[model samples]
Target chain A: MAPVSLVSLGKAFGSIEAVRDIDLEIADNEFVVLVGPSGCGKSTTLRMIAGLETISRGELRIGETVVNHLSPGERDIAMVFQNYALYPHMNVAQNIAFGLRHRNLSRAEIKAAVLDAARLLDIEALLDRRPKALSGGQRQRVAMGRAIVRRPKVFLFDEPLSNLDAKLRAQMRIEIKRLHQRVPTTTIFVTHDQVEAMTMADRVVVMNNGVIEQVGTPLDVYNKPATRFVAEFIGSPSMNFFDGTLEAQGEDLVFRIGNGRALPVPRARGSAYSKHFGKRLTLGLRPEALSVSDASDFTIEVETKVVEPLGVETIVYFDLAGHPASVRAAPNRAPRAGETVPLSFDMTFMHLIDPEDGSVIPY
Target chain B: MVSRGGILANVATYAAAVLIAAFFLVPLTWLVSLALRTPQEIFFGASRFIPENPTLDNFGQVLRDRGFLNYLWNALKLSGLGALGSVIVAAPAAYAFSRFDFRGRGVMMMAILAVQMVSGLVILIPLYRYMGWLGLLETHVGVIAIYIAIGLPITVWLLKTAFDGVPIVLEEAAAIDGYGHFETFLRITLPLASPGMASALILNMILNWSQFLVPFIMLSRDAQWPISVAIYNYAGSTTASTTHLLAAACLITILPAILAFLLLQRAIVSALTAGAIKG
Candidate 1:
């Protein structure tokens, strides 16, 4: 396996830029996930690295050799496409052995390699069956098996599990993670699902609007997001944002919400928002960061609109002075609709962003 | 209860369908009856739906006396070669036009469509002079080449539609698995397009087989003539009467195309509908 690096890469189709100035370094034997919403250029960046797309500008290197001008075949990479594009005419064994046939291997070696990959993927009994005859999960294994037999320096996956049912997607996600653990190639996976990125990545690169938003470990991004987009996108039920003003109150800075509720700012955030006093800012709080308690230092009275019972936990949807907000609470203590609930804010996890530019205020 | 207008509409639909079917089948049925009638009956009898005395004498006479077998062979050779040659040349060009974005792709596609729009008869003089200058004027090669040129524009258009139906993901998978663009075309794209290619070949063969004007203008020698030109000779020759000329030669000339269509009907239907419901 080889480490790959892309420097200032960009791709444009006429006047529209699909990807812009992306620079990333993927270390050898690391599992990196590129996560973003649709049209955010995560897939485009991966295709550029795979050489399936032309780089409008910048350079790509694989282990010290520039590969921008090389074709996908010469770049020594294998890609598992979103649709699992198995050749409809070929059976499982034939599909797995196709890439090896062009190599200088003998028939026996090719057969051994295919059998080994099939066995690794636990698809040994499916070797004789065509792709159409297999289930979706079986077809996914075959797609992976086809890539494994080539044993390239890098493996690129473009939302390979998006077509499967939920249960099968979870199963195949584990299967792909386990396969990477076994082979340990430098792998780059692209997905619009942040859960997949959080669960499977050694390093997750969050992208938005054709640019990299943040790159860090899963916990690093969750606990300390560099931008409001990352903070909002990385969690379920999304982080809630309240437009407010940062002001000095008795020698301490506090964010005053619209209903005259004010929460003291954390000390770590003071340096970031020091110059933004008397200016508009956005306060981001994750659903888990807000707890339901009777006695707390700061509380926001919210009228519950809806309650969703999720067995272990319940999501309480309510209006915080007419602004929408949701809180995660114990299922047994979940509040009823139209009931007023006192929500205690966890200021330690509070995030502050500049309302004008949507950039996170450093602290 | 159903309305009177709805019942009348149903009756009218059935009547229209039957009328269209009869319109297509009547000429073929008449041709068959004419082929079976004797020369005397055809000349003297009333114009009837059925023959008074059916016989195989016209078929036998044409086969034995008129060198019909040689003409049939010439037509088959020319049409078969022309269809195969046109498909082989057009398939690659069609693939390029369908898949690639080159500098003059739109202009090139428009040029092909423009070629199809021009009538072959209007270019007869220029084509004839070009063939004469190349010393291919009276040969089967000259006729076959002209047929290929005439059939190419539409053949490319048909095959290009076929190639465009194949998903780009399949080709990209092949490319990442070490196949080049041409290799991917040969391995993935062509197999998916087999039905369309077969349909295009069948269509072009029918067009070239029944072609009359180009061969009529290009070839001067009887020995090198295709069935179309040979049938024209029967129309002018004194040995065969008009009734015999129409019955025997027409039936013989149409048999191969009918057989080809019968063999490829299923593929043709599927090829026509393959791109209708793509995912």
Candidate 2:
């Protein structure tokens, strides 16, 4: 295994820049996921690292050697593609042994390697079957098996589970995570799905508009997002943002959401917001941080619009001061649509941001 | 429980299909009937489905006297060489066009399509002059070379379409698996493109086997002639009997092409269907 680092990487096609200057370092035996919306250059970054794409500018290093000009084969990497690109003519065993055949390994060694990979992926019985004969999940396993047999320095996955059905995607997600544990190669996975990134990454790199927004642990990105884009992009159902202004009242900093409705700011967050006083700001609050309470520090009346019951928890969509927002509540007492619910805001969990630049207030 | 109109429509559809099949088979049936009759009987006997007295003399005469087997072998050799040459030259160019983003790609593709539009007859004199300039006139190599060059545009276009249908992800995956671009194309792309190649080869073989003008203009030696040119010799010869000309030479010339079609029918059907469905 080898640590890979990309410094100030950029890729441009003609006049359009697909990926801008980006720098990231992936540690040895670490699984880093690049997550973003479509056309966000996550896949382009991964391809540049794999040497499948040329880097327009910047340096890429695998361990100590710069690999920007090296061919993909010389880079010693394996990739699982989104479509599971198994060789149609070759059966599962031949597909898995294709890489080993290029080396000077003996036939017996190739067979043993294929067998070991098949056994690891639980696809030994499918060795003789062609790609067309296998089911989607089976083809996925064979694709992974092909990569596993190579045992390259790095493993790249380009949305490998996107083609599978929902149930199979969930199942394969766990399988991939377990496989990473066993192999422990430096892996870079690219996906548009935040759930996959959060579940599988050792460190998640959230990207937007061809730039890295933040790189940290899953919980770290969720809890302490460096920017507003990371805060909204990392969580399920997304974080809700409300336009507000920062003001000082009696030696305390507060965010005024609307006329006469103000929420107290935490001291740590207050220090971050002091420089932006009287300027337009945005407040980000996760659904779980808001709840219904009779005696609360700050109260807001909302008209419930939708209720989603998920056995353990319920999602309540309501209008808060004319802005639509959702709140996750205990399933024991779920609110119904059209009911006016009194919700309490947890000021400590509130996130403040600059509305002009959409950067977090560094709290 | 069926309605009368539905039954009538079904009968009409079946009758139309049978009529079309009969219309297509009638020419071959006539040829077979003429082959069975003797020269005198063909002229004297009444028109019938079967001959009064069938004979194998035409087949014997063509094989023994006319050297039909040699002509058939020459045709096979020329068509085989021409098709192989075209495939070899076209596959790499097609792969490049399909996979790369070079400048003038659109113009190059349009040029290839334009070449296909120009008939071989229109360029006959210029091609002959070029071959003579290269010191290749009156040679089988000259004829096969011309056929390969004429057939390359279509063959390359067909293979390019096939290569385009294969997703780039497959090549990327192969590259990451320690295979270079050329190795990936050989091991993965070419194998996946077998159906398209087979279809193009069959089409090119048919075209080369039935070619008349190029071989006629290039080859002055009768021994170097393909079956098509050889059959034309018999047709134009005034000394040869009409029975031998119609039965022996024509049937002998077409037999190999018919056999080739029969042998590769499955691949041809699948290839045609693949092109249609993909489009």
Q: lDDT of all the models against the reference?
A: 0.88, 0.87
Q: Write the per-residue lDDT of candidate 1 for residues A137-213, one digit (tens) a residue.
A: 99999999999899999999999999999999999999999999999999999999999999999999999999999
Give, for candidate 1 chain A, the lowest lDDT window spanning 10 residues.
A292-301
Which digits, one per residue and each the tens of the lDDT, describe model 2 over residues A1-363?
Answer: 899989999999889999988999899999999999999999999999989889999999998999999988898888888988898888999999988888899999999999999999999999999999999999999999999898989989999999989999999999999999888899999999999999999999999998999999999999989899998998876887888788899989988886558878877766667788998888899988888664685788788899988998989998766677899888988778888888988878888888778888875
Pick by lDDT: which candidate is best? Answer: 1
lDDT of 1 by residue, B1-279 (tens): 879999999999999999999997887777778778877667643476587788888877877854677878888888889998899989989999999889999899889989999998898899888999999988888888888888899888889889997888999989888899888999999998877998988888888889888877877777767787788777676443467556767787787888877888777666656567764
Which tens-of-lDDT digit does each residue in B26-119 have in candidate 2? 8777878778787766775346658788887888778785467788888899998999899889999999999998999999998998999998
TM-scores, each model vs. reference: 0.93, 0.93
> TM-score of B chain for each model?
0.88, 0.87
In model 2, what lDDT does residue A331 have? 90
DockQ, Cα level, model 1: 0.73
